[model samples]
Target: MNNNKSISVQNLTKKFGNFTAVNAISFEVEKGEIFGFLGANGAGKTTAMKMLIGISKPTSGEAKVAGFDVYKDTEKIKKNIGYMSQKFALYDDLTVRENARFYGGIYGLSKKQIKKKTNEFITELGIADIADNLVGSLPLGWKQKLAFSVSLIHEPKVVFLDEPTGGVDPITRRQFWEMIYKQADNGTTIFVTTHYMDEAEYCDRVSIMVEGKIEALDTPENLRKQYGVDSMNAVFLKLARG
Candidate 1:
C-alpha cells in the first residue's frame, strides 16, 4: 500500500470471451528496481503488461503503477511511465531532431523545453553533424539508443521495455544495458521483457510466465540455485518443461 513501490498487482486477470489471456497474477516491484519479465511466445506476459501499463483493462483485479490505481487512474499511469518496443523504435522518415521534438511535444513539453532537450540529445548522442539527417539513415544501434533517450524525455517514474534488444549486436546490447543501469541508478523503476538470458541476469529480480501464470519469481542466482541449474536459461527450460 505504500507509494514507494513502483508497481503492485493483485489477482490481475484478462479474458477474451471465454478464454483467459492472463490468469490471475500478483507481483510487486520496488522503486528503482529492474524487474525482468520473461515468457515464451503467447505466454500472456504481454497481456499482463498491458494491464499494468493501463493500455488494457483487466477483467478482474487491483493493480497500481507509480502509485496510481490501474482501474481508477489509467490516465495518470500513462503520464508517469515511458514505453519502448523493439518493433517500432522511431519514424524512419523523420530526422533525428524532428523525432525528438515530436516525442517531447507529445509528452507535453513546452516549446522551450523541447528545444533545449533536442539540442541536448544532439550533443549527447553525438549526432550534431547529422542532426538534420533522417533517422532512417542512422545505424540500427544508434536508432535504438535514440529511441530509448526519447522515451525518457519527460523523466518518467517507471519505464516498460518490450524486448528492447532484439536484433542488435552483443556490443550494442551491452552499451544499451549500460544505459539501463544508469537510469535505474538514478531511481527509475525499469520493467523490461527480454528473451535474452544474459539480460535477465542483470535484473534485480525476474518473473517467468508459463501458460498464463507466473511459474517462478526470484533473483537470477536464486532461481538457478533453487533449480540446481548453472544458468538462468537452464532454470527457464526446467520450469517451462515442467
Candidate 2:
C-alpha cells in the first residue's frame, strides 16, 4: 500500500443480478487531491462510489480507501471517511447546533469535543447568530456549507461528495468549492461527483465514466487538450454522447 495514496482500486466491479453497474475499473486517488468523478445519469459513478464508501460490496476486484480494504475493513473505512450526498442530510427540524452535535455523536465524539467543535464551526461559518435556528430556516447555501462542515466533524481522512452543488446558485457553488479547497489544503482527500462541468475543472484530476467504464482520467487541462476541446463541458458532451 502506498502511504501517499488515499484510494486505490484494481479491476473493481459491481453487478446487480445480471446487470453490471460498474464494470472492471481501476483508479487511484492521492491524499489531499480533489478527484472529480464525472458521468451522466446512469453512468455508474454512484455505484462505484458506494463501493469505495463500503455501503455496497463489489462483485470482484480489490479496493482500498484510506488505507483500509473496502471489503474487509469497512468499519475502519467508515470511521476514516465522511460523506455528503445530493440531498441535505441534516435534520430539517434540528437547530444548526443540534445537527452538528448529532452528527458528531454518530462519529463517536465525546460531548465535550462535540460542543467545542460545534462552537468553533458556528463561529467559523459566521452562523453564531443563528446557531439556535432550525436548519430548514437557513438559506440553501448556508445549509449546504453547514452540511459539509458537519461531515468533517470527525476529521475524516477522506470526504466523498455526491452532486453536492446540484441546486445552488453560481456564487454558492464557488463558495462551496472554496471550502473544498480549504479541506484539501488541510490534508483531506476529496472524492466528488458532479454534473456541472465547471465543477470538474476545479479538481486536481478527474475521471469521466461512460457506460460503466472510465474513458478518461487526467488533469482538466490535459483532458481538454486530449479531447481537442476548449472546455470540460465540450469534452463531457463529446464523451457522453458517444
Candidate 3:
C-alpha cells in the first residue's frame, strides 16, 4: 500500500453465482478526499464498495483500505473505517444516546470515551431535545444525521456512505453535505454512493459505474467538458444510452 492512498482497488471483481456484479473495476481514493461513487440501480456501485470495505470478498483481484489488505486484514480494515448504509442501520428501539453508546462500544470505545463523544455529538448537532427519544420516533432527517454521527463515533480514518441521503428533503440533504464537508476537512476520507446527479457535483472526483464497469471517472467539471454536456445527468444519459 502506498503511504498517500487511503483506499486502493486493483482489478476488483465480484460474482453472484452466474452473474458478474462487479467486473474488474479499479479505483483509488486519496486521503481526506470526498470521492463519489455514482451509478443507477444494478450498476455495481454497492458491489464494489462492499469489496473495498472488506465485508464482501472479491472473487478476483486485490484491494487495500487504510493500508491493510482487504482479504487478509478485513477485521483491521473494519476497525479503521466506518460504514453507513442506505437504510440508516441504527436500532429503532434505541434512544439517540443509547444508539451512540451501542456503536461506540462495538468499535471498542471505552465507557468514558463513549460518554464524552456522545455528549459532544449531541451538542454539536444541537439535537439535545431528541437525545433521549427513540430513533424511530424522530423525524427522518434527524435520524439520518444521527446515523452519520454514530458511524463516525470512533473517528475512523475513512467513512463509506451508501446513499446516506436517499429519501431526505433538499434542505436535509444540504445539512448532511455540510456535515460530510466538516468530516473531510478534519482529514476523514469519504467514499459515498448516491443516485442524485446534483450530489455527484459535490465530490472531489466521481466514478460512474455501468454494467459492472467504471465507464467514467473525473471531476464533475471535467466530465462535463469531456462529454460536452451541461450537467452530470446529461453525461450519465449519454453514457447509459450508448
Question: Largest lDDT belongs to which candidate?
Answer: 2
TM-scores of the candidates in the order shown:
0.97, 0.99, 0.98
lDDT accuracy of residue 34 in candidate 3:
96
Off by over 4 Å in 1: none
Candidate 2 stretches with Cα past 4 Å from truth are none
lDDT of each: 0.91, 0.95, 0.93
The runs of at least 3 residues in candidate 3 whose Cα sits more than 4 Å from the true structure, single-residue gaps closed, are: none
What TM-score quantifies how close candidate 1 is to the native fold?
0.97
Best by TM-score: 2
Per-residue CA lDDT of candidate 3, range 1-242, in tens?
Answer: 67879998899989999999999988899999999998889999888888888888899988899999989999999999999999978899999989999999999999999999999989999988889999999889998999999999999999999999999999999999999999999999999999899999999999999999999999999999999999999998888776
- Please report how far candidate 3 places residue 108 from its true position, in Å: 0.9
Instruction: Enumerate clash totals for all models, in the order shown.
Output: 0, 0, 0
Candidate 1 local lDDT, 21-88, one digit each (tens): 89989999999999999998899989999898888999998899999999999989999999998686
- TM match of model 2 to true structure: 0.99
As a whole number from 0 to 100, the lDDT of residue 144 in candidate 3 is 92
lDDT of 2 by residue, 136-227 (tens): 99999999999999999999999999999989999999999999999999999999999999999999999999989999999999999999
RMSD of 3: 0.9
After TM-score superposition, the amount by which residue 105's alpha carbon in candidate 3 deviates from its true location, in angstroms, is 0.7
